[model samples]
Target: MRFTTQRKRFRDLSEQEIIALAISSEEDDAQIYRGYAESLRADYPASARIFDGMASEEDDHRARLIALHQQRFGSTIPLIRREHVAGYYTRRPVWLVENLGLDRIREEAEAMERDAERFYVAAAARTTDADTRRLLGDLAAAEAGHQESASDLANRHLDADTRSNEDATARRQFILTWVQPGLAGLMDGSVSTLAPIFATAFATQDTWTTFLVGVAASVGAGISMGFTEAASDDGELSGRGSPLKRGLASGIMTTVGGLGHALPYLITDFWTATILAFVIVFFELWAIAWIQNRYMETPFFRAAFQVVLGGALVLAAGILIGSG
Candidate 1:
C-alpha cells in the first residue's frame, strides 16, 4: 500500500515541472536539427535548409519560453528534463536519427509539432493564471501551424531530384548502419555454430549434450563476432554509428539466429531435432536474401543466388567437417 502511494506520487508532476520539461525538450530538439543540418549540408543541401528552418522555429519557441519564465518566476530557470517525469517519453539518439528515411523523418517532424501542440494545450488547461494560460494557448496554436509550415519549407527547399537523392542516401546509410552488421551476425551465427553443435550431437548422441553444445557455440560466436565487428571499424568513414551499439545489435541478432535452430535440439530425438534445425536454417537463408534485396538494393535474383548458394556451401562444409 505504501509502495503504491509512492508510485502514484512519482507519476504525477506539477504544471511548472511540465513546462520546464517542454522547454528542455524543445532545446534538445533544436540542437538535434542543427546537427542534422550540419551533417547533411554537403551531400543534401536542400534537406539541410529544412533542418535550418526547424532550428529557427525552435529558437523562437525557446525565446518565448524564456520571456515567460522571467516574467513569472525569476531571473534563472532551474534545469529540468524529461527523465525527471516518471512516464515522460524520450527522444531517439542522433546516431539512430541518421538511419531514418526522408519520408519517415518528415513524418517524425510532423509528429513532433503535433506533440508540442498537445503539450501546450494541456498546460494551458492546467494553468490558473490568465496570462500564463493565454501565452500557452498562443504557443499551442503556433505549434499546430508548424506542421504545415514545415511541409511548405521542405517543398521550397527540396526539389524532386534533391528529395530523391536524399532518400537514396538515407537508405544507404540505413543499410550500412543496421543491415550489413546484422547480416554479418546472422550469417556467422547460423553457419559457424553448425559444426560445433552437429559434432557434439553425432559424438555424444545425447540430446542434452547436443543442446548444451549448441548454446555454447551460439553464445561464443555472438561474443566473438560482436567484438570483432566493433574493433574492426571506428566508423570514421562509414558514418554507421558508435561501434558499441552496432556491435550489440549485431551480436544479439546473431545469437538469436543460432538459438532458433539450436533450441529444437531439446526435443530429445535426433531425427526430430535434425529436421527442425534444417527448417530453421531454410527460413534464415530466405530472410537474409529478402533483407539483401529490400534494404541493400541488391537485385532479387542475385541476392537470392548469392545468399542461398553461400549458405548451402557453408552448410555442406560444416557437415563434412563434423562427420570427419
Candidate 2:
C-alpha cells in the first residue's frame, strides 16, 4: 500500500515542474521554427521571412517566461518535459514532419500558437502564486495574439510578387524531393527490368523462367539504384534530404515500377503473359507521364510524348539486344 502511494506521488508533477516543461517546450519550438526559416532562406525567401518573424516572437515569449520564472522561483529552473505528464502531446522533429506545403506549414504555425496559448492558460490556472499566475496569464494572451501577428507578418513580408515566387519555389522543391527521384526510379525499373524478363521469355519460352528472371532483375535493380542514388549526392546543393533516405525511397519505387509489368509473366500461358506484360508496360508509361505532368508541371501531351518515346526506344533496344 505504501509503495503504491509513493509510486503515485512520483508520477505526479508540481506546478513548478509543469512551468519548467512549458518553458523547455517553447524553447524547442522556437529553435525548430528558426531551423525551418534557415532552410528556406534561399528558395522560399518570403516564407523564410515569415518564419523568421515567428521565431523572433517565440524567442520573446521564452525571454518573458524565463524572467517571470526567475522572479517567482530562482535563477535556476529544473528540467521537465511533456513526457513527464501522464497525457501530453508529443513534439515531432521538424525534419520528420510530413506535408511541408506552404499552406501546411502555415497551419502548423497556427497550431503552435494555439498549443502555446492553451499550455500557458492551463499553467496559470494551476499556479497559486499571484505573480506566477499573472505572468502565465500574460503569456497566454500573448500566445493567443500570435495567430494574427503571424498573419500580419506574412502580409508584410509576402507581397504578391514574393508569394508567387515562393509558390514557384515550393513547386520546384516538391519536384526535386519526390517527383525527380520517383521518376528516375520508375524509368530505371520499367526500362532496366525489361531486358532480363524478355530475354528469359525468348530464350526458354517458359513463363515461370521469365517471371523468375523479371523478379530477380527488379529486386537487384532496386537495391542497386537505391544505393547509387543515396551515394550520388550529399544533398549540399540539392536540399532533398539524407542520401540514404532518399535513395531508399527512390530504389523501392523503382523496383515496384519495374515489377508491375514483370509480374504478369507469372501466368503460365505464353500468350496471356505477353498480353498482360504489354498492358502493364502501357499503364506504367502512362503513370510516369501523369506524374511528370502533375508534379513536375510538364504539359500532359509533352510528358506523354516523352515517356512513350523513351519507353519505346528502350523496348526496341532490349528486343534487338536479346535477339543479337
Candidate 3:
C-alpha cells in the first residue's frame, strides 16, 4: 500500500462542498480587490476607485452565494477552499498586485473574474443537485457579466485623460522604486571602485592581488549601498515602494558594476589585465551615460561628457598614484 497526501479533485467534491468553495473564493477575491484599492488609494486614486467598484461587485456575489447556501444547505457553510481542491485556480498575493503596475492589476482583475466564471461553469456540470446546479449557473453568469461590464466600469471611472495621468504616475513610481536607485548604485560602484582597483593594479603589479582588492572593494561597496538605500527611506512618504526591493536592485547592480572591471584581473599578464580593465571601465562609463540619457532623461552628449570626464579623471588619478 502506498501512502500519500493528495488534495480532493474538483469533480469529486459534493454539491455542498462546491458551494462552500465558491463562497470562500468569492470572499478571498473581495478581500484582494479591497487590498488593491487600499494600496493604490494614495498614489493612484482613479485606479483605486475602479478596484473599489470591483470589490463591491464581489461583495454582491458573495452575499448571493451565502443566501443560497442558507436556503439550501442551512446556516453552516463547509470549510472547503481552493486549497482543498486539486487543479483549482490560485490568486497571487495582493502585495504582488500593487507591484505589478496599475494596468497589469486591471488585466489581472479581468482574468480573476474569467477564472471564476470558468470554475462555476465546470462545477455546474459536475453537480446533480438542482439547487446547487442552478446556483453555480447563476454565479457563472454573474462572473461573465462582470467581465463584460468591466470595460464599462473603466470607462465610467477612468476616462482617457485620467488613464493617461494614472499611467504617467505609475511610470514615475517604477522609476523611483527601481530604476533610480539601481542607477545610483551602478554609478557609485563603477566610478568609485575604478580608482581603487586600478590603483591597486598599478601598485601591486600582481594579478591575484589586484583581483582580490577589486573583489573586496566591489563587495563592500555593494553591501554599503544596499543598506544605505533601504535605511534612507521607508517609502511611506516617498512612495518608492518596498525598501527591500529597492535595496536589492541597488545592491545587485552595484555588484555587477564593480565586477565588470574586476573580473579582467584574472589574466596573468599585467599589461593584458590592465588593458582589459581599462576597456571595461571605458564601457562602464558609457553605459552609465546611456542610462542617464535614457531613463533620467538627461541630454545624451551632456551625460556622456560628464561621465567620461569624471571617469577619465578617476582613471588618471589611479594610474598616477599606482605609478608613483
| Clash-forming residue pairs, model 2 | none
Best by lDDT: 3
Deviation (Å) of 181 in candidate 3: 1.8
Give model 3's TM-score versus the native structure. Answer: 0.88
Candidate 2 — worst ten consecutive residues by lDDT sum?
3-12
Once fitted onto the true fold, the runs of candidate 1 whose alpha carbons sit more than 4 angstroms away are 1-29, 39-43, 61-108, 125-132, 238-241, 297-306, 313-324
lDDT of each: 0.76, 0.78, 0.88
Expressed as tens digits, the lDDT of each residue in 192-254 for candidate 1 is: 777677766666667788888889888888898888889989898878766876798689878
CA RMSD of each candidate after superposition: 4.5, 4.6, 2.8
Model 1 scores a C-alpha lDDT of 0.76
**TM-scores for every predicted model:** 0.76, 0.76, 0.88
Of the pair 1 and 2, which is ahead by lDDT?
Answer: 2
Candidate 2: list runs displaced more than 4 Å: 1-12, 74-76, 97-107, 118-140, 202-205, 228-246, 267-272, 295-299, 309-324
Please provide, for model 2 over 1-324, each residue's C-alpha lDDT reduced to its tens digit, 9 standing for 90 to 100.
353321222125555665576688778878878877877776677788888888888788778778767877888899876665654556667775534666667677778788878877886787777866876797788888777789899899989988888787777766676678878999889877776777677667789888888888898999988988889998888688667667877898889987897888888998799788988999998998898888778899999998889888877776676666
lDDT tens digits, residue span 1-324, model 3: 866548898778777787788889988988998998998898788888888888888788789889988988899998998888888999998877777788889888988998988988997897787977887898899999887666677888899999899889988988998999999999989988888898999998999999999999989999999999999999988788889989988988898899999999999999999899889888998999998998899999999999999888988898899989
Rank order by lDDT, top first? 3, 2, 1
- Which candidate achieves the best TM-score against the true structure? 3
